[model samples]
Target: MAKPASIPGLNPEILAWARRRAGHDVATVAKRLRKSPEDVRAWEAGDASPTYVQLEKLAYEIYKRPLALFFFPEPPEEEDPEHRFRTLPAFELARLAPDTRLKIRDACAKQIALHELTGGRNPAERLVFRDLASTPDSDPAGVAEKLRDYLGVSVEEQRSWRSAAAALARWRESIEEHGVFVFKSSFKQQEISGFCLYGEEFPIIYLNNSVAKTRQIFTLFHELAHLLLRLDGITKRDDSYIGHLRGEEREVEVFCNAFAGAFLVPQGVVRELAGRGAPADDEIKTFATQLKVSREVILRRLLDRGVVSRQHYEQKAAEWTDDYFERRRKSGGGNYYNTQGVYLGKRFLALGFQQLYRGVISRAELADVLGVKATSLDGLEQRMLAGTG
Candidate 1:
């Protein structure tokens, strides 16, 4: 029997570019493709070529790039991974997990889709990012207060939500209403709490849906703070990256965290709650529940007020994180369509579906842009109508 034929005259440079762009070295790609590293290098060096089947797997499976990308005369331009995340430490940026890298690519694609969907204009009456800018010297709480007032969701209104899940939903809508599109994905790397890509009109906050509801809410504001400052950022489970920064960069990192904490549990309220003395953990926990925020936020505020020692606050924060994860482990997975709808959110889904209904985009295009399979489109739309945030 004749062996499968290789594609003649394939551009080895493009194959090499795709692998590097995907953050995989030759050995990693070769291992995943079940090819010898020498053979893979030969293909990349133009001494050999991959068969159509091999190329297909390389395009869709290994590199997570389009098959057409390999045929381009030159690799397309994209935001530099390090440059896009200017606030991320060099150490963290250099060692970004492969899956996290892909998530960043996924985020860039969504930004491109938004441009195509909206005809290069934001639909919101006031685009928040376009209107807001911050300096390193900006007061974190002051900016957060301005943002909260602009969002128009009063603290009294926040307390009325009564549950973090409900608050997250409302906060997502409030942000979306102000023109910042929020997206969620179950990150392949759970240590990534959230990240945002800043654009003048279409700044996006992508949260890890696997995170707890309260933490997600905190992250929503944290990422928003980055957008307000007009910089892209990533939030991890540990913020040790902050320690790696210096000067204005360090200030910006500190500002983002302080901004989020202050935004979620405003200074005045926390101060009042803490009163004349150090509040007990039980009291802090009660305030957190009432505000639909994480205990860490309440504790951090107390620390800022000098009512709680740093050592005590850190110990409690660590314990709460462990408890949260244990509870999450016991909770298990949720319904797929519902999760997807919530991830994409109704604001984004409406844009795609409206475009499809108007014949502006084909069903396939809608599914492609939404990152849902065409066959699953109906189910996703149904969940969108059922109103998952």
Candidate 2:
């Protein structure tokens, strides 16, 4: 059996961040930490203690937060000192599993700054949101097609899937007043990997700026689902399981998953292939290669559609995971998503950076908002001007 994950006595700040990041309640963490929930609470509330070694182990598991995050005394404020991106002291909590941490930090950054960036609700806006919420019988497939057409992209002509997705996002920019940009950050202290926040105006999806291309592609589709559904919230999870969902969030998750599935690889085509008869391993591989998506994604869709039974799907997924990673490792280079540069498309980055450059926002302010340096902004501005950023 696998060894159980341990937790040390965490300080209140670190404990609180860990609990929230892991989405584990106090009682649950207490069990993992080998203490009562109340004991864990006291430790988080500054009333009790966990030893240093214990803290280290606990920090390692929950959000992969560093022991220093717990010991830092005063945490960094939410806003970054440079004003490029929101200053995130809790970022250290994200360093645990790099992929997972990046995803979580992306979510945290979105949630923390969404309100300020999106601003107060407009009266007309609420009605629009209400209408969108109430709108029924809306065809999700049609929505996907509409989005595709709006972007002036035909699935047939696509070479780079990430580029196609970015183009779609760019098209989305023209219709909405708020800025959309692909954001990336190396969250040193964070434990999770990606997240999203639907703002009153601009809804941002943050990806763990540290992961490979295939994963980023999934994260992008996942966040885009959040945008389409118009839900406001944050999500932090590893791809360990499908997801941990509850309340309205579950509905959104379903929608997003559906949207991603349909957008990345059309369901009808997948269903048709599966209907043809039992697909060989090479067939699955060929489909993944043609679609330019991870094989695991292809299997997941097949499983969801009942084209493959649970046992078969799980086995195939496992095999695909091993093969995919091996291929990636052997390539000795970046994957599609990573090579695509930032997760956000260049068009949105240009728009977003310009919004800051035109003196609408001070350079310093822009830097802090983006979690980049002023010098970096200078380079970004030049890149945007060149239409290549």
| Top lDDT prediction, candidate number | 1
* Per-residue lDDT of model 1, residues 1-389, tens digit only: 96556676567899998888777888998898798999999899887788898999999998888887888888888876788887788888877767778888989999999999989888889878766678768999898888878888788999999689999999999889989999998877777898999887688999998888998998998888888888898888777678888887888888988999988888778768878588777888888998999998898888877888989988988899889889888886888888888888898898989899899999999999999899999998888777755
Query: Local error of candidate 1 at 103, Å?
Result: 1.5
| Clash tally, candidates in order | 0, 46
User: Each model's C-alpha lDDT?
Assistant: 0.86, 0.54
Model 1 CA deviation exceeding 4 Å by range: 1-6
Clashing pairs in 1: none
Clashes of 2: 46
Estimated TM-score per prediction?
0.94, 0.58
